[model samples]
Target: MVVQTTNNYNASSGELWPLLFNSKMDDKKPCYLLCGLPKPLECRLPDKQGGVGSTRECVSDKGTIQQRITEWVPGHKLSFQLVKTDLYFGPCVESIIEQFVITDNNQGGCQITRTTTFKAKGPLSLVVAIPMFIGLKAIHRYVFSNWKRLSH
Candidate 1:
């Protein structure tokens, strides 16, 4: 199952991409918090941009997940492939890919779309995707709200 959450903000990609790319954990904190991840989020990424093979680790109250960078386009897009996750989901979870795309808008700002794809080993895949979809949206909204307030 593929779940997507999108957001268009009044800020330019140049302004937003740095915040997202530089502060990966802080960028994801809103969703993690809404979904019950505690304070002090933990995230680790390689110091070098070794292209697709670069690995990352993210830990929250929900659990920990390991990911490998699949794509990286500075100020444009980023994508990661899930290598492992503590989210058992009845052991039916096979893989997950999370992507964020930033595009320049003609309206003088930027549009960022987040797409999360889930591949399940069993029928319960939807069980994980649904809540995740909702949580992702909530994260986007929170970010947008804060971005607006801060940009002013």
Candidate 2:
């Protein structure tokens, strides 16, 4: 399953992509709390070039979950692979591919388009994808909204 959205974000194209890539989040707030534990927060990406399947771990109240940056092209493309854990459902591999493209909307501002791809495991993918999408959308929205607030 793949989901995509494009928003103006009311900011300049040159400026927005960098901020999105390097999420300048302050850990002192409730939103930052989401980044920890049983529920995945925002990702904390690697600062340097690393090979495939490089895993990053997170600890939650439920258990620990792992993520890896499987692909990259710097500002233009990035992907994260979610490692399945015994604490979640059954066997599963999930990833989100985000692309930040700059386009001239031809109005006054520019557009930052985010495309997300969701890939699942075996037979139960249909049942699982729906709920998984719901969670991802909600979390993504929360992070963006918080970012807006902080910027102002």
Candidate 3:
């Protein structure tokens, strides 16, 4: 299953990419999605690195999720695959991959498209599909709203 969302911004991709991928967590508010299920209390890149093969750890009250960067194109795209997660949904979810693509719009700004792919475990896949999509859509919108606000 996949949940994807796109939003336009008045800022260039260069200006917005860092806001989403590289900004310091302390410089902004903590990310909290619906029901606090995947709330990330902290997110950091090891050794201040940013690129393919680099790892990122997102820690929350529930548990930590480690991701390995699979693709990195500065100012245009970024992608990562979940290496391990101890969150509540870990057992039901087999693998997760997230990607963000940015493209310049004719209006001198840019559009960001976020895609989240989920592979579920067994019969639970059918049961969790709808709810997972809804939750992820909400999460994408929440993040988009913050990006739109911060880009200015």
RMSD to the true structure for each prediction, in A, is 4.0, 5.2, 3.0
Better model by lDDT: candidate 1 vs candidate 3:
3
43-103, model 3: which lDDT tens digit per residue?
6786577899999776666798889999989999989999998888888888889999999
For candidate 1, the per-residue lDDT at 29 reads 58
Number of the top TM-score candidate: 3
Candidate 2 lDDT score relative to the true structure: 0.53
TM-score for all predictions?
A: 0.69, 0.60, 0.85
For model 2, how does the per-residue alpha-carbon lDDT over 1-152 read when each residue is reduced to its tens digit?
86666665555555554455345444433344334323433444454333356554434344554557566554344455556555454255455454445565778656656566777677887887886666556545555665555444
Model 3 deviation from native, Cα RMSD in Å: 3.0
- Estimate the TM-score for candidate 1: 0.69
Residue 57 in model 3: lDDT: 73
Report the C-alpha displacement of residue 64, candidate 1, in angstroms. Answer: 2.2
Clashes of each: 0, 4, 0
| Per-model lDDT | 0.65, 0.53, 0.78
